[model samples]
Target: MERRPRRRLLLHGLVGLALLLADLPALASSLAAWRITRQGALELRTSPNVSLQAFFEAGTRLRGPRVWVDLPGAPSRTRSIRGSGDVREVRIGRPTPDTTRLVLEFRPGTELNPADLRLVGTAADRWRMDLRGLSRPVLLGLGEGDIEGSATVAYSPPAPFPTSGAPLSADGLPVVPRDRFKVVIDPGHGGPDPGAVGIGGLRETDVVLDVSLQVARLLQARGVQVVMTRTSEVDVDLPPRVALANRVGADVFVSVHANALSMARPDVNGIETFYFSSSSSRRLAGSLQGQMLAVSPGSPDRGVKAGRFFVIRRTVMPSALVEMGFVTGGLDSPRLANPAHRRRLALALAAGVLQYLGGR
Candidate 1:
């Protein structure tokens, strides 16, 4: 057959070649906007929990409780189209019980024509929401409408949590009798995981790595053995980050990351340390929080909180996560961005490690 026009051919490829990895019957929801399937079975799924999955050909735009997908695929050249009504943001509460809706606000405009929207993946709640935006067919044109309006949708996901409780602190962590403990510092996010971006191209990974290395060097100078999750800018999944510390038989574990809140600047300030419920985690958070502030004077003290994060939650030893500063919002960004401030953060973290060992 003669080759179809370039644009048309590309559009047709949206369904994609059925691949071996794709479970044929499973339908994946697009994270962007509401979808109405025409032919073939569609499965809507969000990660860690499969929401909707079934085989179907014809489907209508069902206004559920919380989701917004881009208007049926649209032409590249089409800036705006006359939508019958307004479309809004989508919110997700839980995966097991998936609910989505559209929020629209209407204002008078001369022949309101809204731009065709496409769905982007969901934020966190696992890659499920993000994966929803993956596969979609193209809709090149739109019907008549001079619609002008806006809508907002909210998804409140049940707290994402894993199945098991964390290992208790120092109970049977293989901590040997030693002068100083072998501490492994894990700097969260690197490579592909930009973590969070800032005004000055400051990346979380680069900053944390620098701080981790500093902490390591400081500890080493004090006759304490030190190990780092990574020495270079590279991708390291969460699991492996902890494994490094475990592998090195580290006496304690510390995971470091800067916080970010773009939409709403958090009024909360200063350092907040987190530990798993396990006994080990508690001790670790206490130690880190105390010293992190000692080095960085005036650092906001959020105090130590407990939560199950992969690194600290699973570690067999005392573990804690240090939120050095809020990268976005409040006044934490400017200071965290300073090299002297970063060095102080490192030194304080190192000192915490020393203090924790001293406690025992």
Candidate 2:
């Protein structure tokens, strides 16, 4: 009887100790692993891939200026990855017990928007911070592009650096083209996603699709192979749209949308073209914006902007999101409603693509 009691006590002690040991790591914030993965560009992913687990508790504010986190408790030493792409190295710093910051050092002229840097959940306990827009410092060489068919072929960054070979554009930078340049055109809203409703009850989905189809036709006629995310008014999820463009190895991706301002401020209207924060993407956007402005000389030019929209951000090609006109703006609404105007916009967009493609 004595021996039995002693054994039970020992087992209980061991179990309690094990539990305590397990809880120890949890007491201090645990950062599992920091690793890099690449699609067309490199991204830093946290182990367990979720948000900083216990490190950042509730009320922990994610302060900007630069990415710094104020946690409930102190975390381990800062984690670092040496220079890659636009990132010289990304450091997770705990300068003080309650304050932690993610310090990203970028090379000169590398544009980084707070909106572009994000923590996206990848798995049950995992999340990924995609920095593709800010940097693609290295290319592992192009994947075999010989695979037949657009649905099967996946295009990658050419082995040469993005700025290495090819004819200089008007801006005087080398832009290499795949064997056959391909373009993906995404119509903004479809199916149940009617987008913005404006004067005379205009449906954004219908108007955008009509204009997108026209754009596709013009590009196709110009001998530039074109892929449409949807030809009919059917709902297409954003992921699949991006996947289609990536799978086909698109040279350029353009998402067409019509703008809508507040009902109260119906007068705010113009053409705004957005690109991811990259020189190539910005060049593409500028080209398109210029062409649109030239064609619609009377329309207000909202100018080229930068954004991390899903279609443009995810696609590993020169991509842009074009907002043709404001459906709610009294001056622009009537023009967007006109079929001729839509056609002209399509032609202008096609011209922009051609210009970006070395006027081919």
Candidate 3:
């Protein structure tokens, strides 16, 4: 009888342990299901000073089950957001278009750490990640199969905004001017890949998309056609992107993206330009960098770099990728998330296109 009571307690204890073990996976599954969404599509902007904002694009919905969304001028931070069913009001802290920032919520006990960030590049724009609690040794890789376990993935960027800088051909023959050039803007990373996330919940793709549209509009207004690789929120592969660019006979290809880092106190903020592996690409990158700095005064010049990006590597025309800014640095995030700063960036890029075309 004495042993019976003790045995009963032991049995109950074993059952409790089993139950606890069962619940762990459930907890993890629940954690995996936690998601984030924006009511209308969020606008991406470049920052000036310490300001960041997401001007809402009404009727454009950006809904997903991802952990977080990035903003301009911020580093990659993971989060889970949801709505209260009916037309949920999304708030970003500024009154003006350039200063407003959207708000999000997360599960209780979730940690927000700034130091756990590492920068990884997608096909074009990149992410500044804080992957402290998201599994271990988080990674960012390319290819469709074998995605790293628990690692975030990025989507291809939207089509580049077309250029109106068609002046003359190499033979001194003037290139015919179209009403609007059909430009395919590529904003890299989507779906599972939240490229970079910084303060005010900034995202890499979100930031590039905003700038891409602005660049598109600027060129369209100047009588150029514009097409986007992935207009809404969708993933695009490299081969398809290359085919699209070639299909449209893109006069110039510009991939829009942000930059990131992975180090202690690695506050990296600067502007870098890239072209395919060619001598002329260097000149184009240099020219674009100069033009970008013209509008963004006091910005760091990382100089033109040489890299064999898949999109740039495969494209047959003049192609370049622009790293507008970084989201992780103390001084960079605010600079990236500001609307004025983005506008200036767009203007500088436009001027660069003009110069490139005029020179030819």
Candidate closest to the true structure, highest TM-score? 2
lDDT accuracy of residue 89 in candidate 2: 53
For residues 1-360, could you state the per-residue lDDT of candidate 1 as single tens digits?
A: 001111100001113111011111223322232322222111122222122211111112443122222211121222322232221221222222222212221212212111111121121111111212212322222222211112211111122211112211222122333555677777776544557765466677667877776766656556666665544443445655565566667788888888776636646457788988877678878888887777666667878998767787767787888888776645677777777778777767876777778767
* Per-residue lDDT over 1-360 for candidate 2, one digit per residue giving the tens place of the 0 to 100 score: 000000000111112111000012233443333444445222222222112311111111332122332222345665665655544555766766654445545555554444344342222123344543545543333211221221221212112112111322222122324346788888775543468988889878767877776666556555557777655543445666787798778889999988887867777878889998889899999999988887676789989988878888888999999988888888778888887777677777877887888743
My TM-score estimates for the predictions, one after another, are: 0.50, 0.51, 0.50
Deviating ranges (above 4 Å) for candidate 3: 1-176, 180-182, 263-266
lDDT of each: 0.48, 0.57, 0.47
Point out where model 1 deviates above 4 Å: 1-180, 263-268
Model 1 poorest 10 in a row by lDDT: 1-10
Spell out the clash pairs found in candidate 2.
48-125, 48-126, 49-126, 49-127, 50-125, 50-126, 50-127, 83-88, 85-137
| Minimal lDDT window, size 10, model 2 | 1-10
